[model samples]
Target chain A: MSYHTLQHLTVRLLFDEKFVKFVYEDPDSALLGLDLSKEEKAQLLAIDSRAWSYDSLRRLRTMRSLVEEFKASTTLVLAETRQLAFLDKFFSSPQFHDSIQKRGSMGLAFAEYLSEKFRQKELKTPQLADVLRLESLMARCRREFQKIRVTPLPKTLKDDLRIKFVPGADVGAFQANTVLTIQKIEKYLFEVNLMPAMVLCDDAPRLMDLPAVETKKKSYLMCVPAANGVSLIDIEKSDYLVLIEARSSLTIHQAIERAMASGITKSIAQEIIARALEEQTLHLV
Target chain B: MTKFFDKIAKIPRLGVGISGEFGSANKGIEACLLQENYPELVHFFEYGGDLDRGLDEHVRRWASTGLPTTYHFLDINIEERIDLTSDWLVETIEMAKEINATWLCGDAGRWHFGRRERGHQMLMPPILCMDSVLESVDNIRQIQEQSALCCLPENPPSVVYLGEMHILEYFAEIAERADCGILLDCAHLAIFQHSRNLAPLTGFDNFPFERVIEMHIAGGVLKETNGYQYIDDDHSPEPLESTWQILKYVIERAKNLRAIVYECEHNAAEECLDNFIKLNEMFPCKIETPKLTVK
Candidate 1:
């Protein structure tokens, strides 16, 4: 076969499954106008079996699975086939972006695909962007959790009680624009109990137990790492601000001074600092 | 440490294979990246899924750890796309540049290992002229030349239905014509023999060992399919006893080796690290001094 023709067939075989079918359906026409050997032609045609078709379909299916995992961690759980349908839209869309093969890029591809679907009015959902934005932030949070450095709290330093917040503490940086409430997501570990260090959340079933509040206002998320998954905890905005201020190394006296001066009574101010240390909102440097 | 493979003079760089321990390869990568000690070069599969936020976030982890990180990306689809080549170039090679990757590694064609031999056979693009061997070579050369990053194509695992072509002959001509090095996937070679229903290429003579700049060895399960037996590398199967033996054969012959990687993502972190240490012991970073200087 001429080099270019061989190259063309070879490339098509590696990329297009449809062409593979076309070749299989009409072997003579497929082999015509080309210079493949008897062996080469037979080999290409031999791929007409179930085993070969399954392999190609498996790879394409894997691309769908990749984004499917991202979707699982980001948005509300959907039926397996439902998620697959969403992915099918992207894979079948005119814009293929990259092969949604990589974990991070698959999410972007799905998000873009979802946005396009929303634009076309193909999807009947009004919260397309909201869902994508939420899932992307959770994915980001997971990445950030990996980067967190967990240091040992030196004994003498721990006794000092001046360092309130740990080195890798952040409250308002969840990266999601939507105000996620604890009531909405008892399962949302990405926001509620967010921290990297190993945490044993005692009978304290969740975040700073703000029971009286009906909705979590723009709150702080504490991502705490456990054995298998991350725990996202919700904290009051004021309390979160206090933890941020504690980054300046507020000693027990300074902390009480700041809390009291900010209009809290002496006893409440003392309890707040004690609570921060106990919960590891503050740790020894 | 001065040592001689067939042609190499320097000690080879080393890397660990990163695969998701739980379910996601990306998750395993996140955990691997957390290691205080990581190689300057890494081989990645499915590591580029999310660029703007997901993969980018993980890439940023390498920043404070050190400077100038180089990743060897294997997740990219390498088979030529007449029109898609340019966009693929932008997505992969450009992504490599953005991440400070030194070399982009990909299989020559048919990136995955399928149950059936013909799975990868369907990707041939239709063009009218040129030799297949040289055309494939040009495809690699064009990619290597176009990208700021160095591109190395690895050999695909062989199957019986495919047209007969020796891996060594294919790599030798491509290396010579494209001026490109090979990322020799030893597992693919092992499975190639198994899948092709042929005896092993026991003798190493005439093989283009010098063209191989890097090597990949992974643990695979012993498998039987269609009356043939081979080692399967997909699905992170546990390694068989002879896996290391096969690896030793290739490492000894790859004189120009710059990196010898142990694919351990499928195994436990401790087990993978232990395997990594064991391989390092066999092929130490500091090459043993030659017994006698050549006069």
Candidate 2:
């Protein structure tokens, strides 16, 4: 291997426990089969691995931090003991191993893992998975939305929703009580509200507040990103569908047309659209 | 543009400061520097999220101290990652310019293992060759040119020495090659001293002292694992007694010293600020107020 590659491997030896174990135990599988000199191998072997052995690409701490920050409710649900365990398991599992390749945002990766676990019915506290997914997406939405330095909505709101996530595709939809059941676990983690044809999570306290809340559920919630404030807002059902359809090739007016076709009056559609805009649930199209 | 060294040379006094990259003002660290007991120039280890939002807020936070700064990037090991990108540097230097940073500093050693996009489980073995020195020099030139700011290269502490050349001499030659100053992290120097098995500050005359535009003073626990001693740059907020001696030695010897930074990335901010008080008692006005931070 080239010198850069060799240097990389040596530093890798410093951090990776699995690589060190293989090198010390197997002695068969060399360091990436590199043409390491005896002195080089000797240097690699001489490191104090125990200090850095647990860090592994420095993600255990990083992912753990993200889980602590974004998925505070999930963190509470997992309790203190399982926090590291979940992160370690996630790190070692395919969910972490396969997707951890995207190095820029560890929060997004951890969120994806929770979302996938929720989708696959693999979570122990399934409701916590929902909260984790919501928290993660909120963080992502806030970050993505900030880059779109526009006050008014784009002319083509359907093609570029200003926000990248969709309701049903990126976020899961749940009945009012199911969400309320999840929220009841930690009402402060999320706010459940009763809105016309939907439950609104807009104008709720930030996840950091996790205030005491009542477990009142309405019709439904679709976790959609508010186009600003790095906030995540969930909208109610039929209205959620309108925003979902509007996130594509349809304009705001077109989306309202679709909602009107689905037995909704123009006034109700206008009210929902106004509420969506007011809550930052949907940007102008 | 007048080189940063030229401007800082005008300051004409030994300076004292600590890493300003602590997460928030509520951490109780900012109060330490602001206290009347210490005169400080702030240095940032990093400003998170690039120059995204909060650029003005971050710049104002550092500028509020009205202390001079040496904004340093400790992550990109110029020696190792010759292929480092310039995009982030653009935003970082822009922020530094806004903060009126005296110098933009980084390390001569490599810190990261591999590229971020790949999920690598290993770190690149430390590259200690002469080419690494050359690579660092080139990295300095490219960064300085792109950032439109004066760049200083600091010597990083290492667990493994991978080249035949001595670390001190390598630092000296590279500073001369890069046409920039050096940010001497004294804690790193102590580790290098131990790793080389040299008597404490035994051959200090050989390295390039004049090139050091900034000095990073901090301490780490000397961790022994498997018969090897590595400086874990995590614990111990104050510079160790030995590191203090080296700092004094550098202060006595160097001609072009400007700032001394107390890097306590893991330690509390108040503790880092307290270091200046101890530094003053030990060195007796050797450090006043100078520039920088780490990332």
Candidate 3:
């Protein structure tokens, strides 16, 4: 328990800027509650506040991992504002630390945090919310897929094959064409990857000019794990309904019946099922 | 005392190391393999991975070539009791079996503070105290028993250290208590010495040198910020003199040393050749290099 307390204090010193300042200014007051030995207190006090300050190597390392995990979102945010002010707020928020303690996915936590910001009108970029949501869903799907073994489909789908949604598949509706927006982001990332030296040069064009996403219409998307990576497929409203129903074990006939009851025509329902099977979004049981 | 002698003997003398997507970007392993003098210099591959991230195809392909390999985990915090999850242990054993790893090794440091999240992940050294030493011993024994592989705890690198015990004394206690071998990383030791303002070989005399089965050498940079000077373990091709000094001292003392890994997966092949040649000379491999003839 003492070791745990030491570790907790160490983590707080590295991450919580407020606590670092408090400890730096008033070590005795900050050390009042904690049950630490004299040597432990001395060791904790010996930590140089400047070494773990903002822009420290440890923070930079964390920033690198976040930027790598959410490259497109980071680039888009960077391009729009030229600064990650929201990240500063996030780092200070209790949710960030809670996510770390709970052992939850940071990508998902950030996406949820950004969602809350957008909901509160704190974030000006509307399209970024959709992008973050899609990215979060894809990351969750990939992680879930890693846990469950995917049963390989036979060479052919039988006529009476029972079908179900893949174990980690998910569907969502967004205000913007997130798939297309992500494609544009990927294109920008590709350019950045090709010109590494250009990225290092401040004077060089910071990034490819990304146009604002048109928010006139809504886009439905299905996220599923593919062989190489996570795959995003654009789906129609009817396709979404069918996949939702397919969450339960259903034969092809039952899936079509369920879709028809939801006002989808029989032919359309059959067609969606066929396409889903081909895409491996729905697997035969 | 010789519980791990057979496992130690199975490890090759001269090896190259790759950790977590290191070789995929630069093809450092491929570069080493392309060299005409590769056989004489390189003896085995040390695969460092986190079970959470899984292994990449490049590492698997190299591993499947029937070359000897050792598994180095990057995720587990050996001093934290809560980190030794059964699921993680099972996956660790599976990964080792998949790669046919000769033995397992990892830095016995707090890899993460609270839990294993990306934002929390860091290679911070444990608070060098008796409490931490006992905790690390228990974790090491658990891992060694569960995985059925000789687990060697390596010293983690850090700019700032806390506690009353020296880093050498900390690992020596763990090795003695856990009854396990140790992986002495010269670069990390040099960093600890530089940070604490001690000589590189300051504590080498008291260490359990006979328990050292593996050694690691990497390049580092002397950096200063806000008047705080420290060494950064950057894994460059140019190693520091202090690192070489520690390696020399250990080489003279660690009679059970079986493997020495040059952790230069990010450096270009030409940039690494001199160091590889130096390692080969310092700890020559038994395998013979073929002579190139003019056509």
Query: Over the stretch B1-295, how does candidate 2's per-residue lDDT look in tens digits?
Result: 2364565566544455556453444452553345334443332323222323434354366666664555655456576443466645666677677766766876656544343221332223236666677777788888888876667776776666565556677777877777787777778778777776775586556676777767777777776765555666653776676788888888887777766666554556566655766655543444444456676
How many clashes (backbone N, Cα, C below 3 Å) per candidate? 54, 26, 0
- Candidate 3: where is the Cα deviation over 4 Å? A1-19, A27-41, A53-61, A64-82, A86-89, A149-167, A176-219, A234-285, B6-21, B24-41, B51-67, B81-100, B110-121, B204-206, B265-295
DockQ of 2: 0.13
Give candidate 1 misplaced runs (Cα > 4 Å): A1-36, A45-285, B1-26, B29-34, B37-54, B67-69, B74-94, B110-130, B146-149, B158-161, B222-231, B235-237, B286-295
Question: In model 1, what is chain B's TM-score?
Answer: 0.71
How many clashing pairs in candidate 2?
26
Tell me the tens digit of each residue's lDDT in model 3 across A133-241: 7777776776556444446766765557798877668787776666677778787678777877886686765555455666677788888877765787777888887
lDDT of 2: 0.56
In terms of docking quality, model 3 is acceptable
For residues A121-227, what per-residue lDDT tens digits would candidate 2 score against the true structure? Answer: 65654345445655665565544442333256444334223332233222345434444544544454334322322323355443332323334543444444443
lDDT of 1 by residue, A1-285 (tens): 343334445433433456556677887875665666776676556542332332345446545444443543223323212354455445444344232211124344555665666577766433334445445544444433332333444434332466645534444433232334223433434453465242343432233322232223333665444333445567665565455557576666666666666666667665655576666656544
TM-score, model 3 to reference = 0.74
Please give the DockQ score of every candidate, comma-separated: 0.10, 0.13, 0.30
lDDT of 1: 0.49
Candidate 1 positional error at B80, Å: 2.4
Candidates' C-alpha lDDT: 0.49, 0.56, 0.76
